[model samples]
Target: MAKKESYESRVEAFLLPLMEENHFELVDVEYVKEAGTWYLRAYIDKEGGIAVDDCEVISRQLGDWLDKEDFISESYILEVSSPGLGRPLKKEKDYVRSMGREVEVRLYKAIDRQKEFTGILSAYDDKTVTLTMGDGSAQTFEKAGIALIRLAFDF
Candidate 1:
């Protein structure tokens, strides 16, 4: 595996059981470099929501495990938190839970001269996602061209 993928996978493996035990859902795990610093972040959630205290509890435990395992060679900051309202649909369960919800879809390339669209998430499969727009039209996008697909929220 690539270094980034390996780090994410290892972190996820460590998080899975901890999540189940705590009744939290693992939303996503990422190992990414922003500017020059690498960050390993885990986003978690539950039926109601997540709070700062929840994040603190997971962070301490995860930090301890990472220290003991010492698998990552590079310096990285560890973060555990809830995936906020705009978090993307990154996994199967994310899609499952988001069905019939309004979502914003951003594409890597334009389709019909537009690259971003907001609609009710109607259907999704391994290869595509279908959204029903306000105009009563359904837009189906190939998964490969999607840059981000996330729940839509407004202030």
Candidate 2:
């Protein structure tokens, strides 16, 4: 577990500068094994949205750096891409950016006999998140209680 985290941290450290230089927001990075294949994935974004070309540019540059550094001993596939529309709000930046947008918040345990709520995200602090529900009522939830929060999509 510690080794996995160490590799993830190293990868994030190496990618941060490259993302900054390319004007991309470093959303998240993960090192995971699926179907017996190791994968190192980097999720990036920008002001509007990230393009395929943007991913290509970052991928090419970061790939070169990774090759030079040779930090990971195991073979892994590297992927650079945008965090899609329903990406989880995991960081402060994500919450800030999501303010005034509709979001679906799921709790670790039921609150008011419900485990999920959908509303416009009104405010967020380190400790809590406030949402304006359909009936014009405001509800504030402890951040620690939330299991997941992501943009809500209407279809």
Q: Pick the candidate with the highest lDDT.
A: 1
Misplaced by over 4 Å in model 2 are none
Write candidate 1's Cα lDDT for 1-155 as tens digits: 89899989988998999999999989999999999999999999998899999999899999999999999999999999899888899899889989999999999999889999999999999999999999999999999999999999999
lDDT of 1 at 117: 98
How well is each residue in 19-58 modelled by candidate 2, as lDDT tens digits?
8888889999889999999999999999899999999999
| Candidate 2, lDDT over the whole model | 0.92
Q: Candidate 2, residue 100: CA error in Å?
A: 2.0
Taking all chains together, each candidate's TM-score versus the true structure is 0.96, 0.84
Any residue pairs clashing in model 1, and if so which?
none
Lowest lDDT block of 10, candidate 1: 78-87
TM-score for predicted model 1 compared with the true structure: 0.96
Clashing pairs in 2: none
**Lowest-sum lDDT 10-residue window in model 2:** 1-10
